[model samples]
Target: MQFLEDPVLWIAEWLREVLLGWGASELVTNMTLNFLGAFVVGAMIMVIFILLTWIERKAAARFQDRIGPNRVGPFGLIQPIADAVKMLTKEDTRPKGADVVGYVLAPIVSVFSVLMTWAVVPFTQKWIGADLSVGVMYVAAAGSFGIVAVLLAGWSSNNKYSLIGAFRGVAQLISYEVPLFLSLLVPVFLARSMGVNDIITSQTAVLFAIPWLNIPIRGFFVLAAPLSVVIYFISSLAEVGRAPFDLIEAESELVAGYHVEYSGMKFGLFQAAEFLHSFTFAALMALMFFGGWQGPWVGTNNLTGWLLGGFYFMLKTFFFYMMVMWSRLTFPRIRIDQMMNLNWKFMVPVSLVLLMGMPLIDYGLRGQELWLKYLVLFLFNLIVGLIAFAWAARADRRVKTHTRVRFEGRPVAVMPQAPAAAEDETAG
Candidate 1:
């Protein structure tokens, strides 16, 4: 039997005992502990948000081969806090025609929506805020409201550009949602549960064998649902308004998007929500496809269990987050039309197919040896990958061919068309 002990939860129990000793009723003590635990999680997320800004700036600078905010506090560690202070003290202007209620509530809703989703994510074993039975659905529903926030920000601002940005954001969100939801089904089906904790538990087994090595890395869905992972990551990028998918805020186009009228802390709230959402998606992706907090099965010890579990969770979450930042730095923003096509035409179809076939694959693999299951998963994924690669290669060739033909067809010089023989026309 696997032993699980969460230090955070343990501390909460101890605190609850103290409250009880202070004449608190059982219900009161439970509520106190729960609230305290929530506050701690919120505080941790906020601190991470602060640190993430500095990390992103520094990381982006390195990616661009330049020094970032090194002037502030030994590598600009305190730069984000300084920025936060400025935002709080900064001049704020509300549009004359702005809707007072929605304008004020937009940022709050945007920030809170993502925060609410965090309540279900498992940071460590037994350390989730509220592990709902329908955790996956809860996350999806919570995240979907982000579109409402964008629309509210845009509409309340009464700015044409903001409205356009919001419209684009809505289209993007709705478009990517199909694939995102479909990809989510892969993990849910494989895990045979809608609960996020149950899904994490289901990823305990290894996927495939390493060539020439007998090592078995865990997370069967990573192999069985490789494309889903790719689709989920891509969709999450767009959902969070990161680069390449940041059409919502294209400064060259939208002048800052749905939150254009927002200044200072209000604007900062939007930024905070974006980073937090992106990182949260990283954690969710890690949980669904990769083993969430399931590293080497360190038997539950007294105090060290929580620490070790958290270390593993953070390692996987950060790995995914780092990759997200890396992609943001590396990839240039694609055209909006191309982005739409990628989601609607490519990602959606692939995810749908994967979603439909998952059950069939699972059924076939039932009553089979572990190795046989692994082998079937490996082959299915390999075939899909190869087909995708072939299609991409062909598309690339056609694009290159068209470009070359277009360039060659253009005449460098045509003697100005010989001026249409002006003298002869005059004589006639």
Candidate 2:
């Protein structure tokens, strides 16, 4: 498995060798290498954060059948550059009576929390900044920090709308974390390790190739625990404040949500964090469920392999980002209550059951053939789905009027008039 050697490690080793061979001190050489790695990772994540602004706009344009940013540059690739300039030059205005400290800290907290998760993510075998044994737990913890930022922004803004939005955000974030963490436990349980690198290594073998039938298989932990993947993905969308679950930022009600009092890059930074988190969420899903950095013969050398590894990671990441874009364009936003009910009433229970059941099934079927093992796991998923459907049907009868709550105080509402002939008949 020398082919699996981390490119980053090899490069650092080569640097160390050259430095030592030149009579340089070991401490200095090691320090230099660590600094270089940190610079590269930080720079890469920030650059992507800027580019994703354009990427999401372009993706949304395509979905809506509109010309996205063709005017700025070819396919509007430089559109984000223009927007960045605008945001930087704009006035940083603070609303009167706003808390200076928390208002400023909110954007920094929001952006940093999401960016820091990249430290433990393995782009290649050796590319990670840290390989902490509790990497998954670290990620889950980091992901929740955005909620703190939201609360700060809302409370500090001294705006009623901001506070309302912040409370809504708190509810959504608190509700989703349950399912998100529960789903995350599946991979941890199966890999028998919490380290992201170890989890990646455990998935090195074929996912599902049948010897008798000659059917090829493609899987990582995602295939073994498909329910977890489903729940995690849905929860992640909510976590990032995407549509259908974005009631936290319900513009129709909250008027720009928690950061309503901020202007200039401060406002821009909060917006960037939201979109950036969405992309990061997709990347994490790819790494967790899609055999991250595993691709066919990407590079022959350690250096080239590292390049290839980063490529595969980005490709897989953008694929999920596209899925997120599609989901946003397709679904209408649900009311706050519906959003809560969907998460707490449905997703939380289903995800809990899946998490509890997977280990039992795997242990009980340890001696059985691989196919039989999978069959039992799949049956378990099917039963959970049916249970969800039945519960939903029963819920429908109980909360049939739930959806109309959002329209309770409609103002400036106008009813459309029929065609001339229809209108004339109605008058007659």
> Which candidate comes out best when scored by TM-score?
1
* Residue 56, model 1: Cα distance from true site in angstroms: 0.3
Q: Per-prediction RMSD in angstroms?
A: 4.9, 6.3
- Candidate 1 local lDDT, 1-428, one digit each (tens): 12335556556667877999999999998888878777888888988899989989988999999999988798888899898999999888899899999999999999888888889998776778888999999998998789889999999999999999999999888888888888898888888898898998887766565878777677646766777888899998988988889988999999998989999999999999999998899999889988777777544554455676778888888889898999898898988988987887678877776676667776887987656675676577677757866876787689779989989878677566555788778889
Residue runs of model 2 more than 4 Å from their true location after superposition: 1-7, 10-25, 207-218, 298-304, 401-428
Steric overlap count per candidate: 0, 0
- lDDT score of residue 231 within candidate 1: 86
Show where candidate 1 strays beyond 4 Å: 1-5, 206-216, 392-428
Give the CA lDDT, 0 to 100, for residue 161 in model 1: 95
Clashing pairs in 2: none
Model 2's lDDT to the true fold? 0.84
lDDT of 1 at 249: 93
